[model samples]
Structure formats: C-alpha cells, structure tokens
Target: MMNGIEAVIFDLDGSLVDSMWIWKDIDIDYLGRFGLEPPPDLSREIEGKSFSETAAYFKERFSLPDSVEQIKADWNRMAWDKYMNEVPLKDGVGEYLDWCLSKNIRLGIATSNSRELVNSIARVHGLEHVFQCIMTSCDVGRGKPAPDIYLAVAGQLGIPPRACLVFEDIIPGILAGKAAGMKVCAVEDAYSLEQAEEKKALADYYISHFSEVLQG
Candidate 1:
C-alpha cells in the first residue's frame, strides 16, 4: 500500500519457504547427538543472525568442540538435505512473484543465510531467475537488524531505500529493512506470526500470505 515503491526485497528462509520449522528439528537432532538439549532460547538467538554468527553463538552457548566452520558445515548438510528434498514454498509465493514481475517491479533477495543455501532453495522453487539480485549477509559485513544487508541490496538494484519495499518474516529482518529506511511488509509464517506481530511493529504492512500482495 506504500506509494512509489520501486523494488521488492525478500527474505529467503521462512519468508519465501517453509523451512524455519526444519531448523528446530536440526537444532534438536544436532544437540541431542552430544546428549544435550537445545537451550530454550536457541531459536530466538539464531533467528536473524548470519550463518557464521549463529555457529559462533552455538559454539559458545553449547561449549561445542567443533570449529565455527565445521559446525556451520554440519548444519548446512542437514539443512540443504531438507531444503532440496523436503521444503516447499510458502503458499502462493510463485504467483505473487509473477505478479510483481508483470508489474515490472525489480526484485531482490536479502537473507542472513549463506549464498549456497539461498541459491539451493531458490533453484528448487524455480526462483533463481526471478530475482534481479541475490544478496547474502556474508556478502555484507553485518547481518539482519544491522541495515547493511538491505542497504547493499538496494544499492545493487539501483533503487533508493525509500523506494524499496521489503518482505520479511522475522523481527531482525523487519528491523533491518526499517533501519535501511525502506517500507517493510511483514509476512507471516507458521513459525513466526505471533512473534512478528509482537516484536516487528516497525513494518509498514503485514500479510499472512503472499496472495495479499495481489490485492494492491
């Protein structure tokens, strides 16, 4: 509903695909391997962090023996398997992307996930070609809630931050978009709706489904 928005930037994991719940399973299984239970707040801590940041947090919090890269690789192996073989797009996202394309709105992806992970899921959903740019937090010096990632994406798209709209499902992503001075549309997912409502009030709009985008 924001006027004069020229581009749309999307968050990959829970926003575009139903993969957040998969992370919970990964956390439980991975921690259980060492006879440890996942800390209650583990999911919240990692929700908006970059892969490397998350690994570091896990290592420190769990006293894990693996190096950060090793831990990340292990997590990626399990995640990629789920993403490639099991994850599905959030309902109606493909149609919504097509609608945006038809409107000639530039599109980009800005995610805290690694580039490999984002590309894998985008490829599985046939969305690789739909985005003008695919930017990962690794490409920037900081991750979500920092504004750096979204600012980089806007720069890549040749759009002013005020002229861009961001679609985000998590608090950190929404805050990042807001910090970048863009209009944000908070998208709801099974795992994030309640948290989004309570913690992401900075978003300019809220939609439970991508289909809501077509209503404009």
Candidate 2:
C-alpha cells in the first residue's frame, strides 16, 4: 500500500513494544500510593498525551499533592525497570529494522513517550543507533492528532512528508501521520483490537506485522 516511502517513522509504545498491558497496572499501582484507585476514564484521559502532559493531568485529576515533575519522576522510576528488561520488541520488528538499515532506509521515532523512557527501552534492546531521529511530543508543542510530532520527525530526517511512511498501532497516531501528509500503516495490537477496522480505514494500509511491508 505504501508507494513513495523514502523514510519510516514509528510510534514506540504499542507499535514497537508489547508494553501497553503493563500500563494499566502501573496506573493502578501509582494511584494506590496515594490510597486511590484508577478512575474509570483513566485510559481515555491519558490516551495520546505526552508523558509530562499525562503527569500534569494525573496530578490535577486526582488532586494529588505532588508537583507535575515529581509525579513524572515517580512514574518514571516505577516504569524504568519494565521498559529496560521486560518490554519485548513486537513480532518481526527487529528483523525488519535490520533489513531497512541495510537498505539505508532512514528510520525515526515520533512518540508521546518521554525521552528517558524511550532511551531506556532502546538501551535494553540495543537499538540506540538504529533510528536517525528520536522525537517526543515534548520536543514539539503537542501530541498526536496535531501533526506536530510526525512533521518534526520528517523535518529532521530531511524527508518530505509524502516520502515518509508512518507505522502506528493506535488511531490517534495514524491520524497524526495522515495529518502530516505521510502514508500511514496501521499495525495490529491486541490492546487496540476493538479499533482495528477504524485504524485500517484511516490508514493508507494495515499490516499484522512489519514483515508485510517487506512482502509488499
């Protein structure tokens, strides 16, 4: 489905790693520190937000006494071990990235996650040198659905928007890529299974794994 992809931009969380399932547990546990349970809308409220943005939201939403930066620090400490040791690269991803590297295809990461967490995962996976650019919404002004993150990635990669292919697992990330005038490929993730059809409809293509792009 991709026709003019000179570069590939990826979303990190659900797309690159099987890490989403652990987030709800983190949220519950983090809130439990303050003797609170996660709110019913916790997932919805945090969806697509930058790491710092989410921390601020949590502080305000739960009336926590901690400052935004402190909240972020606490969560980062909680999540660092999981990201470094337990997060597995999604199926076929390492091979695909290696293949793309051999072909000199520029790769970049544009994510809502913080730079520290992204680095932690990269270090553990030994993928620190793979991406030409690693950007977060904090580097730009907004998160997904605003187009800023993808555009920033393409800009730094020195590729035109139309020459970039974005791989994402969630609707917001897909829309962000499309909004930036890039071709988007929606990847399957069990956490987002309910929105599979919506993802395919919004993306330029949909694939179960990165190897599908090699076949294409």
Candidate 3:
C-alpha cells in the first residue's frame, strides 16, 4: 500500500489529465509544417523529453529550419485551444485530489509540459491552488526518466523522495519517480495501452484508475 508516503507527485499529461492525445496531433501537425509526417515512433521518440528538448529533436530529425524557440512557440500555439477547452481530468482524479487535500497530503506536479500549457489546464479545472508546488521540466532543465524533474518537485514540496508517492501513466514518468527513490503507481491510459504490462512491472503499484487507490 506504500504506507508512510507523505506526498503525492503527479504527472500532468496522460496521468492526471487526458492530454496525451493532443501531443500526437501536435507532433503530426508540427512536422507537417516541414512537409513531413509524424514518424510511427514519434511518441516514443519524444517520450521523457522537455519541451525544448522535444523541439531540438524535431528540428534535427526533420532537418527543419526553425529554431527551438520557434518550434516550441508553434507547438504552444497549436496545443493552446485543446488544452484550455477540451482536455478533461482523468477519471476519478478530481475525487482523488479531494482525498489528498482532506488527508493533508502534500501535492506536487512534475511534468514534461511547458509551464503555459500546465497553467492553462490547472486554471480551467480550478486546480491551481490545490497543489503545494508545480514544477515543469523546463524548471529542472531536464525531463523525466532522468529523475531531475521529480527531484525538483520533491525539493519544492520539502518532502524526501522516499516519502513521496508518484502516479504516472508512461514508462518514463514511472522510471523518473523510482529514480528519485519514490514509490510510483502506474496509472492506466488508453493512449499507452500497448505498454500497460510494462508499466505494471516497473511501478511499485498499478491501478487502472485513481479510484482504485481511493477505494483501497
């Protein structure tokens, strides 16, 4: 049950929110601007990378002419509407957040998303104040699977890594939390259906929905 965990760290996209779908679309359209299509492994290729890192990957992979800032700006522009208006909290996440708040457990978000996109989602969902701290990959200067972002969030929350419990949907995110010496729960996301088993194996716990953790 991961007893003694004092704080819960969450990954925004695909974990607490259903925003993973938007990224693939963004990648496809972003590459199309260079008259190219998203590679079949595009999602895997950019997994665990920060916004700027992803942009750098795109530029070099496609031989694009735009600078990293230009590419990041373009992605932000393309993703703004969907993140603001369409993305919804993952099933049972709102209730889970309420549970955490009631229990006085600290909350922190360690995400690969840009600060703008994360803020937009948090604002729309009225979740801006629920967290004790919010940290982006940009803030850490590195992305998930590297442990930097997770460590940064833990540091901001003033919680020891072993006292933090992380919920993640992707392999990279799970790895990041574990690397930070935290207990990780791999949550289910249809977008990553193929990696469901792999995620289960890597995580300290596995649940199909946040509700399962609550129910227990």
In the range 1-216, model 3's lDDT, one tens digit per residue, is 547978999999999899899988887777777788887988898898998898899889889888999988888899999998889999999998998899889999999998898888889999889998988998988888999999888998999999999999999999999999999999999898999989989998998878899777
lDDT of 2 by residue, 1-216 (tens): 545667999999999888988788899999998999998878877888888889888988899999998988888888888887788999999989988898788999998988899988888888889999999998997888889999999999999999999999988899899999999999999888989999989998998987888898
Of the candidates shown, which would achieve the greatest lDDT relative to the real structure? 3
lDDT (Cα, tens digit) per residue for candidate 1, span 1-216: 646988999898878887888889999999998899987777787778888888888899889999999998998888888889989888888998888788898999998887779988878878878999999988896778899999999999999999999988889888999999999988888887667656446788888878877776
What candidate 3 gets wrong by more than 4 Å, as runs, is: none
Best by TM-score: 3
C-alpha lDDT values of all predictions: 0.86, 0.89, 0.90
> Residue 147 deviation, candidate 1, in Å?
0.4
Per-residue error at 76 for model 3, in Å? 0.5
**Which residue segments of model 2 deviate by more than 4 Å?**
none
